[model samples]
Target: MHIHFIAIGGAVMHNLAISLAEQGHQVSGSDDQIVEPSKARLKKANLLPEQVGWFPEKITEDIDAVILGMHADINNPELVEAQRLGIRIYSFPEFIHEFCVNKTRVVIAGTYGKTTIMSMVMHVLKTLDRAFDYVIGAQLEGFDSLVKLTATSKIILIEGDEYYASPVDHRSKFHLFDPNISLISGVEWNDSRTNISKEDYVNLFETFIETIVPKGTLIYNKESTILREIVEQTFDCKINRHGYKMPEYSINKGVTYLHDGDYRIPLQVFGKFNLSNIAGAYTLCEWLGVKRDDFYKAIASFKSSIRYLEFVASVNGSVVYQDFLFSPYKLRTSIHAVKEQFPCQGLVTIMELNPYDVINENFLPQYASSMDESDHAVVLVNKESIKDKNIVLDDLEQDIKRVFKHKDFVFLTDLDALEGYLESFKSLGFNLLFMVSPKHNTMNIVSFADKFFKNF
Candidate 1:
């Protein structure tokens, strides 16, 4: 099979290209901007585009299929040419569905913890020496690529994202994946370009449940009332609802210990949210025929994905960590997780409202009081971003202040001011947390911390 990718520089797009190339499929791709990691990885695999821009000549009918990435615009020249030539174009999610149609597809979906849960299950499977294909959102420790597909693998674990599949496809990406085994971490709407109303946001997950294959199982977070209601009222699949009301666990001196009736296993990762994710992963593994003992053994060594609670530096008892958290629910969960781990320390939380949904004026209220759990909270937003998005800065700050209900909490639009404020802070044995999505500009914080705490 011959496959060509339009806008293949995307993180997932590049991985899919390499996965197919490794599978012995003749693969070629073109992108307007091929950036780091993707560029280097594709070069190493001999799949990087010779040129940066798209070429209509590259869209020949000889290609078996053309995979379109969300990064590519609808009016992309190669895409237009592909359509003119009557060539089939598959959205990234659609192409994934094509490959896993015959396999037992296990999709993990939610605004948060999907990647972690998928990684956990994949790690367990790999430890068991199970031959399976997978496509997780983040890079795992041992995995060379974010995607792996094979003709012989009978199962595929995918991190199902709810964002749009393509500019032409208005449906959520997860809707394209008809999973035999599905898990919904929780419902927290995002990607404001697609989801306009809260009801519409909730409906997307319902649609995912309705799209499940016959006799398939849905493992959902019963803790989310919205998800529970949607699954109960809308879904007819064999539902196995799981919640956060599991056995108690605690963190002791940076180590997490889980209690399972008579068994207690020490975990390398800490936090209650992570514990819930572990429970969700455990349920999925059990459904996949992994015994309890084996699951525990694999999870004991799990060190979470990169940039999700990743350690940045430590200076005089002040530790700084960065996480890929942007949505209100995720922000609250991450803050609580840090507070739980370092309850005695003064927690300084910095959040970047860079996502389109979070920066929008209409969605500002959803973030109200999301950071109340932190001892000291600061909201960071680029003023130019507000102007670019056509959102009012005063309106955003008012809503944020109202939600936070703290007079000491600061909101800064200038990077220099934020940097100065952070540098001015005296060492107070506090834990500093910086949270934002990958698309946000956070390298400044990383750079500042690296320079200030070089010796530490």
Candidate 2:
């Protein structure tokens, strides 16, 4: 079979192209810009487009199917040609579903902690010597690609998001998975582009819960009032609901230990959110027939996906960590996790309002009490981004200061100012925590961390 991708350079799309190629399919793809790992990975597999731009001539009817990335516009030239030739088009989620339709799909969904929970489950599965296909959003430690597909694997793990499946397919990506087993971490309105109101966002998850297969198992976070309320309502299908909260755990000398009846298993990962993540993963893995003891044994070594609470450097009783936390829920959870993990040290958090959605003046209020856990918090945003998004920083600062409950909460829009502020903390001996996100400019973070840590 021949499959062409309209925007194959996307992180997930490129990995899918590689997966399909590995499956012995003739896969070809194009993108306006093919950058870094995607370019190298595709080139290694000889699937990278010979040229960067799209070619209508390549969209011949001989192509069995064309997979569209969310980055591709509906009117992309190759897409237009594919439509003219009456070729079938599948969005990324659609194509993924096509391959995993026969497998027992286990999807993890939520506004926050989905990646961590999915990574936890994947780590345990791999450690337990299980064979499975998966498509997680982050690059886990042992996985080469963000996605993996095999014809033989009977089960597949997927990170389900409420964002659009594709430009043409306006439905949330999670709706397409039709999971036999599903996990909802929690629902918080993250992307304004997808759902403008809180009701619409909550309804999206409600719709997702209904799409589960008959007698499906839904593992959810019991702590989420919104998710709990939604799941209690009627659904057409007879589904099993299992809700999870933080397991019994204690932080000893900056190391998190999970308690069994008598044995305490030390974990590499820390934070209450991660503990909740572990509980959700344990529940899902248990349903998959993994022994509780074996599951905990494997999960003890789980380090989580890259860019999530990654230890960057340690200097003079101060440590710096990096995390891909952007939304209010993520920001608050990450901050609390660090403070709880190292109760003795002062936590100085540098959070970049890196995602465009959170940069909005209207969305600023959601972050009101989110940063209250931090001894010192800096809400970092690019000045040009504020101009591009038409956000009034002066007004946003008021909301941020008010919500953070700290009169001294700093909002830095300049790189130099941010660097200067971070440098001043060099002598303060506080734990430096960076909360960032993708699709946002994070170079400043790298540069600042490198410079500050190198100075010590």
Candidate 3:
């Protein structure tokens, strides 16, 4: 089979291209820009495009299929050529579903904890010698690729998201995946980029509920009132619903332990959201034929993904940690988790907001009291992000101050000012918690951590 990717430099697209190429298919791709890891990985797989720009000649009649990435525009030349040639086009999800239609599909979806939960499931399965293919958003430890598809695997675990599948396909990505086993971590609308109202966002999950295969299983976070109501009100759907919450756990000396009767299991990952994710993963694995004891044993050694509460450096009692937390709910929970783990130290949190949140007026109220747990909170608002978005910096800062209940709040837009602020904390001996996301142009967090904590 011959396959071509329109925008192959995407995080998932490049991985999928390599996987398919390795599977004995002739895979080719084109992208305007390709970055470090993707470029290196694709080169290793012998799948990197010879040229960066798209060429209509590459989209030939011999191509069996063209997989379109979300990064590509609707008017992409390659996509236009594919359409003109009457070639079958697929979104990555659609192509994934094509190969996984006969397999047992498990799709994990929700507002939060999707990546952690899916990673836990993948970790336990791999430990137990289970043969399965998967598509996850994060790069977990020991996993070589973020996307995997094989003919022999009987089960496929996918990290499903409620975002547009592609520029051409307006359907939500999760809607394309009809899962035999589904899990919804929880539903809290915070995606201002989608420009959808709260009710409309919730409706996406309600529609996703309808997509579950009949008589299949659904594992959900019952703690979410909105999600629970949506599951209950969907009268036409036929599925077995299993609701899970945070399991019994305790933090001792900064280590988390899960309790089961008289046996106590120590975990490398901490936080209530993670504990809940473990519970959901355990439930799903149980249905997949893993015994409770075996699942617990394998999961005891499971570590958090690199971007989740990852330890960076430790100096005496003060430590620096990095996390990919930006949403209001996640921000509040992560702040509390770090503070709870180290009750004796003062936590100084540096949070960077996404550009979508900077322009949206409705997102400010949701951030109220989100950073209350941190002793000192710094919010980085990139000045360039608000350039054409019609945002007033002074008004935005004042509104943030008014809404957020942090007593020691600092609104900083300059990276130099942020560095100086962080330097001032060195003498104060406060633990640093960096909550950042991708596309953060304000500061290079990992570099800063290494240079600042070099001696520590």
The TM-scores of all predictions, comma-separated, are 0.87, 0.89, 0.91
Clashes per model (N, Cα, C within 3 A): 1, 1, 0
TM-score of 1: 0.87
The pairs that clash in candidate 3 are none
Best by TM-score: 3
Candidate 1, residue 440: lDDT: 67
lDDT of 2 by residue, 46-159 (tens): 988888998999998799999999888988999999999999999888888888899999999998789888888888999999999999887777888899999899999999
Query: Please, what is the whole-model Cα lDDT of each candidate in the order they appear?
Result: 0.81, 0.84, 0.87
Tell me the lDDT of model 3 at 8.
Answer: 93
Candidate 1 residue 108 C-alpha distance from true site, Å: 1.1
In model 2, the runs with Cα more than 4 Å from the true position are 190-194, 354-359, 365-372, 387-411, 426-429, 450-456
C-alpha displacement of 422 in model 1, angstroms?
Answer: 3.4
Residue-level lDDT for 318 in candidate 2:
75
Candidate 2 to truth, TM: 0.89
- Candidate 3, residues 1-456, lDDT tens digits: the string is 999999899999999999998899999999999998999999999888888998989999999999999889999999999999999999989999998999999999988789988999999999999999999887888998999999999999999998899998999999999999999999876566457998889899999989999999889998999998888888678889899888888888878899878868999888887888899999999989999999999999998876788777776677778887647778888899999888987888988888777666787788898999999898998777667777888998998889886899999887777777766555345688889875554677766665455433
RMSD (Cα, Å) for all candidates, in order, is: 3.3, 2.9, 2.5
Ranking by TM-score: 3, 2, 1
